[model samples]
Each structure stands twice: as structure tokens, then as C-alpha cells.
Target chain A: MLNKVEAYFTKELKEKAGILVVLTLLLLVPQYSWRLFFLLLLIASLLPRDVHRGKIKLMVSLPFSKGDVFWISYAFLITIIVITQIIGGAFFNISLSGIGWDILGTLIFSSAYFGIAMISVSLGFGNFGIPFLVLIADSFFGAIGNNWEFTYNLFRSPSGLNPYRMISPIYQGNRFAAFVFAAALLITAYILFERKGTSK
Target chain B: MIVKVENLQKSFSGKFVLNGVSFDVKEGEMFALIGPNGAGKTTTLRCLYGDLTPNGGKIELFGKAFSSKSKERIAVMNEERETFRRLTGGDYVKMWSLLYPKWNDKIFSNFALHYKFDLEQRVETYSIGMKTVFYVALTVASNADVLILDEPTQHLDPLIRNEILKVISNYTLEEKKTIIISSHEIYELEEISTSFAIIKEGKVLYSDTVDDAKASHRLISRDEKASQGEVIGLVGDDTLVKTDKDVGRFPKFEEIVLGYLGGRREFIPF
Candidate 1:
């Protein structure tokens, strides 16, 4: 079972390049955009790990409870976030603390990406839901940013045409709100996707 | 091991593909679900393997009732398995093993090498017979008590076909494993099958011991068109008589076929 899980990341799924692609976009691009990173993470987490119907059934049947699958999938999404942060820190010639806001933003984005993707895809939605949910979160988070007490202080206010304005991937004091954002979008995705039948 | 299929009923729309089919398969016996196309043999096997859900009925393994967990005792090879074109043959087998709860890697992998299987070779390039062996080897290595093989010999050369049969015979006679196999290879079934079920047009025609099949039907034939024998279904231009009565000489199916085709007219055989 240990080897099986290892194999899933290594052999079964080619995840390393996906992680690398997200990192390259995050670090090298002149204008900062968390959306692309979020998008990549969404696809990595949600896509059917196995295309064959039988193989898909087999993967789901691994000695894993439904909860185990849900959380492990969550952890893999986070790993991507961590990898990106470490890489960004290296490229910026700074240590972890110097790149604090970027790390925080990535974490927030990762959780939101995973929560929504897991809910939607497990409930049988497709890759499109990744961008859709992220867009909804961006709008809703922007609404919160304008109305709330904290977002004004947490982000240093975006430079013009900045993509970060769309969502408070992180707000300083009420950081717990990130979880709320993730959970709400996830719940919505679940509700919508679950409406489809399991007859097939 | 006792496999009791209780009132299995599955249908699409109002048509019942499998209607109330039930049978008990005993341990160490070669059982074939002989049926024409669409006769529910595959459907019944699918339900037994937990791949399909019947509208009604249940399967019992040993004395316990069947459940999803009960699948650990069985390995199923689908009739037309979608072979992964990208993965190597070894990896393909390994993936199947991961799905198996009792998956023993050493035993299965060793057998692959013993068969001179190149694990590095991709499955898309494999012949249909090699692919079948790939599926079967994974199951056999799991040491599962029950093997549900559908159309096991669909595309095998004669020698490879014999190899598979030999493997099956060893498992049943030596290891005392139970098997439920469905195939059109009637001649092979006739050789190894102890108890058999005949299914046609999505229903079971009959199920009984091989000896019973031999004793229950008599082929009555004569060269003379005037001669006649009591039977349910008889076909052909020549006059042929068939009867479901015990006969002395035509005890085996080969003899029965020969008796039907090439026998001389006889006034009586007592």
C-alpha cells in the first residue's frame, strides 16, 4: 500500500511537470498572477487519474476509505503549493520569510483549488469547473475585500491591472476566512455536481 | 466452496436479460456457463464479480452472503477489457494487483518472468492471447479461491490455449480452487467440465453433471429417411431421430455426433 501510493504520484500520474509549469509561471512572469497557479493546481487535483473506467474503479477501490481519498487528494494539492513557494524563494534570492505574502497567497490558492476540484470532480464534474469555481471565488472574494475591515490592510494594495485584486487568497487577522472561502466553494461545487446521477 | 446465485434478475426496460437464474457451484469443480450470445452468461458473471448490479437476487460465497468485500475471494477478467495502450505489460499486471486485496507481487511477477514475459514491453503491442495471459496471470498470482473468467480463450493459438487450460486444470485438481468460466469453446469445456450449465437466449437451458448430459439424451438416427426418433429439436435434410433417453453406445458427445451423422439404419438396438 505504501508503494502503491508512491506509485500513484510517480508512475501512475505525471505530476512533477505540472508542478514545475505552475512554478515557472509564478516566478518568471513580470506581472504576478495566482490564477494560473490556481488553474494548474485545480487540473492536477481534479482530473481523472485513470482514464479507463475499470482502472478508475480499481483506483477508487484501493484500501482507502472515502475520507482517506478526500484528504490525501487534499495533501497532494498542498504539496504543489509548497513546492512552488520553495522554488519562488530560490529564484528571488530570498529565504522563506522574505517571500511571506507569496507563500501565504499560494497556500490560500492551493486550498481553494483543491477543495473545489475535489468536490466537483469526485462528484463527476470536469476540468472546466476548475476555472469556473476560481472565478466565482475571485468575484466573491473581491466583494469581501471591498466590504470587510481586513483586506484593506493585508494586501499592500495591488499595483495597477493586478490579478490579486480578484480574491483575498489571504487576509491577515481573519485568516480562517480562507478556510470558509474554500469550504463554501467546495460545498457549492459538491451540490451542483452531485445533482448528476450515478446510474452509469 | 459453495457459490449460490439466488434468483438473479437483471433487465433493461421491461426485457429481462437475466431472469431468476440460480445455481450452486461446488468447490474444485470445473463449471462453465455455456450460452449463446446475449444469453446472460456474461451478465451473470459480471454480477457475481460485483461489476454489475442485478435488479434483484444475490450471490452467496461459501456460507456467507456476497458483498463488495466478498470480491477479495474472486478475480474477474472482463470479456473485452480496455487494455491501457501506454503502460508496459508488467506495469499493467501490477496495476491489476493493486486493485486486488490479496495481491502477491512476488508470485505473479515471478510467473511473468517464468513465462518469459517482458515486463518492459507495452501491452498495445501484445497479441490478444498474451493479453489474456496477462489478465489471467495477475488473477492466478493473487491466490484467490474463485476465478471468474469470461470468454477465456477468445483469441489464443492452439498451444497457448492448451497452456491456459492446463493451468486451469492444475488449479482445480491440485489446489482445489473453484472456477466459473464462460466461453464458446465447448470442446474445451467438454474436456475439463465436471458440472455445466447450458444457457441460450439469456436464460439457462439446463444445468447438470457431465455424466447426466451423456445419460439423459440419446441420439437416434438412421440412413433411411423412413426412420424416426423422439426428440425436441432436430435439424438437417437427412432423416435424423433424437431422443432424451439413456442410450448404451452413444454415451459421449463425439459418439452421439457420429451416431447422428454416420450411423447405419438399425431396426432396433437393445
Candidate 2:
């Protein structure tokens, strides 16, 4: 399983050069842009397009099941996100509080992104169109106010005072609810992908 | 039996690809699935390997339910070469060795040398024939219990094709491995296959051992176009008849196949 995870990471590195380059460029952005940059890169790293339907079929046909492939890829993407954050933190000279908040925020954001990518790819939404559509949906909902907080603020930086922003980096503002939301999304994605995995 | 598929059905968007297709492959037998294009051969094979779940029916391997454990013992060569084309041949094999528990490095190295496989070149650089050979080699090297090959000779030159067949035959002979090969190459199949199934339009038209099938069905030039003696089918003026009585001798494997396919009679021997 460890070998499989390493193989997936190597494969992603070779296949997702564009995503890596975009994530690298995010480091040069100003401090204020760090929130958006981190979110964008988190979402970008989780784009399911790196593994196509053919590759999925091949992978699933191996000694691993569909869930195995999903979780392995999930672990790989999460690692990439962590490494990127480490590099970004060093370059931007973020304070301890900022780094702590960024890590938590990135985890929640990545969980949501991972869920969306899994559902999109498994449900036959072409990989290229999904991330673009996700960004659009996020902005649309974000513009609608806190009423759609759970949906719109999925990738936003956590706020300590804002109750609507249940999942934040610093102060615990309904952080439990945020974790539950993330868990729900991840579980739903797993169920849908496993169901869609039924042979055609 | 090593493989048992009962009432297997599959469809895509309401269009039936396999309508209750079923067959059993005994241990150590080379079972050939012969059918024309769009005849559900590939779909059936996919179902057997659990690559695709059937809409209905049961598939058992080694008397247990099918799952990843079944997949571990099965090595498949699909019709499409949709592999990671960016990886070099050596890298691809290395990746597979990690995934397949029974991978045999020594045997693979020996076979690669004997076949002159290019391990240094990326898959994209290889010709279609080379790609086919490379993947087939990878599958064979996995040393799985069951091997499912779909159109293994699709894009191969005659020399390479013969060499591959020789290697496969040697593997089966030595290992007693069960092989399920789906191909349009009937004559090639006749050379190695112990039994075969002829399917059309998502249904099994005939399933029997090569000798039994030949012994039961005979080609006769009869007048008045009579569909007699359990008429299998017809081709031009000849009629293919399956009878208990000796009709001199049965036709060749290809002749019997053409007779059954071309003949207009529907004989369901389930």
C-alpha cells in the first residue's frame, strides 16, 4: 500500500506539471492574497483530471479496490498540499499563528475539494471542466452572503468571530460543525464513486 | 470449475451489451470466447475479471465471491492499450511488479531478453505491435492463476504473433494455468484452445469442447434447403447439422464456425 501511494505520487508529479507550476506561482502573491492563493492551490491540487477513466480502470483492476485507489490518491494530494504550505510559509515568513491557521484551513478546504473531485470524476464529469465549474460555483455562492456559508465558505479562511464561518483556523467557532460537514462530503463522495465503480 | 458465471447481464444506457450471458471454465482449460465485433465478447470478459459489475447474475472464482482477492490472482490484457504511455517499458513493469503480488522478476527478465523487448524506450515510442507485445509480456510475467486476454494478437506481425503464442503455450503447459482468451482469431484459437464458446448479440450460441463441438456438428451439401438433424446454420447451399449418427466426418473448426454463424437457424443448446 505504501508502494502504491508512492507510485501514485510519482504519477501525479509527471501528469500534473501544470497544476504544480500554478501552485508555485501562487507563492509570489502578496500576503493578503495568501488566503485565496492557498485555497486555489488546494483546490487545484485535488483536481481529479490527473487520473483519467482509462487509468482508473487499470488501477482498479489491480490488486486494489476502487476505494483503495481513491484513498491512496487522496493521501498523495494531501501530502502535496502540506509540502506546498511548508514552502509557502517559509517564503512568506508567516507567523506561528498564521501557519497554524493556514494548516487547519487548508485541511478543511482540501477535504471539500477532494470530495468534489471524486464525485465529479466518478460521475463522468470530464476532469478539465470540473475545477473550473467548482470555482464558479464557489464565487457565486460566496457572493450570496453567509446564508450559503457551508457551501460558499467551504474554501474560505476561518474566522474566529463569525459564527457563520463555523470552521476557522484560530478560535473555535463551530469547528465541530465544520468537521462534520467535511466528513459528510468525504463520505458522500466515497459512496458515489464506489457505486459508479460498478462495471459498465 | 475454476470460473462460473450464471445469468450474467450487463447494459449501457439501456442498450443491452450482455443479455444473460453465462458460461463455465474448468480448471486448466484454455477457454476461447469467439464472436464478431459488438457481440459482447469484451463485455463478458470484463465481467469475468470483475472490471465491470454485471447488472444481474453471479460470478464465482475458486468457489468464492469475486472481489479484489479474485483480481489478485487474475492478470488481464484488455483490448485497449490505455496504459500510462509516458512511462518507459522498464518503469511500467516495475510499477506492475509492485502491484502484483506474484510478479516473477527472474522469469520476466529472461523472457524480455528472449523476446528482445525494449525496456529503455517509453511506451509512446513503441509501435502498436510493440505495445501489444510489451503489455502481454507484462501480464504473463505477473504469474497470476488466471489470465484473461482480449484480442491478444490484434496488431501483431506474423512472426511476433507466433512467438507470443509459443510463449503463452509454454506457460500454460508448464504452469497448468487457466486462460480465458477472447479473440476473432478462430484458427489460432483452434491450435491451443481446449474448449470455446460462440456468442452473438449478447448470448451464447454454442459452448462445448473443441472435439465435442466438432464431433456433434457436421457440414453436408443437401438439396431442397432442409434444416434437418438439428440444423445449426447454413452457408450458401451447405447446411450445418448436429446429429447423433456418424455423418462420415465433421468439418474443420473454421468451417463449423462459419456454418453456425452463416446458418439462419436458431438452436439454443442451453
The TM-score leader among the candidates is 2
Report how closely model 2 matches the true complex, as a DockQ value.
0.44
Task: Please report, as a value between 0 and 1, the fraction of native contacts recovered by candidate 2.
Answer: 0.42
Off by over 4 Å in 2: A21-47, A50-54, A95-100, A128-131, A139-173, A198-200, B224-228, B265-270
List the global CA lDDT of all models.
0.61, 0.73
Instruction: Please state the CAPRI-style docking class of candidate 1.
Output: incorrect
Q: Please give the distance, in angstroms, between residue B124's alpha carbon in candidate 2 and its true position after superposition.
A: 2.0
Q: Where does candidate 1 clash, by residue pair? A: B39-B202
User: Residue B102 in model 2: shift from native, Å?
Assistant: 1.7
Among all candidates shown, the one with the greatest lDDT: 2
The weakest ten consecutive residues by lDDT in model 1 chain B span B232-241
**Cα RMSD for candidates in order:** 8.5, 5.1
